[model samples]
Target: MYWFLLLMAGVFESAFAIGLKLSDGFSKPVPSLLTAIAIALSMLMMSLAMRGIPVATAYAVWVGIGVAGSLTLSYLFLKEPINSMQLISVALILFGVLGLKVTSTG
Candidate 1:
């Protein structure tokens, strides 16, 4: 359950990042508000996940998910083209996340 919450927190992190980008520097009200909501939810989920997981592991995983998710989501939503270098970087981050999960207990 805590692991799931950590993943959810990461997803929320991605949502807020996209929302921030879409907000055009907060000039847009809707996206700005959505960004705020996402940020709150992300922090909440992270806090909940920390109850069962070590802080370092949970924080790293959350950030990993956010980075990988945001990269893909940005390409999809913003029509940004992802180059080979970025793809490799994301792949590495994913691998690192997997490594952390495999090594971590509780």
Candidate 2:
């Protein structure tokens, strides 16, 4: 359950990061509002996750999700470069996250 919450927090962190770009420096009201909301939700979820998951492990997982999700979003929506290196890095993050999940479950 806490891991799930951690994942959701990561997703929200990604959302708000993308939302920040979409908001164009908060010039656009709707996207900016979404960015704010998403950020708040991410923090809330991460705090909840910390209750069960070790702080170090949870932070690593959270960062993994944010990095992977944000990169994908940037590639697909923002026309950012998506090269082999980028994909490989994302995969590495996934592996690390999975390792944390598996090993920490005990």
Candidate lDDT (C-alpha), each: 0.94, 0.94
lDDT of 1 at 10: 98
Can you write out model 1's per-residue Cα lDDT over 1-106, one digit (the tens) per residue? 9999999999999999999999999999999999999999999999999999899999999999999999999999999889999999989988998998889887
Best by TM-score: 1
C-alpha root-mean-square deviation, candidate 1: 0.7
lDDT of 1: 0.94
For residue 39, give model 1's deviation from the true position in Å.
0.4
Per-candidate TM-score against the hidden true structure: 0.96, 0.95
Write down the RMSD of all candidates, one decimal each.
Answer: 0.7, 1.2
Give the runs in model 2 whose Cα sits over 4 Å from its true position: none
At residue 39, candidate 1 shows an lDDT of 98
Worst 10 residues of 2 by lDDT: 97-106
**Candidate 2 local lDDT, 7-89, one digit each (tens):** 99999999998999999999999999999999999999999999999999999999999999999898889998888988998
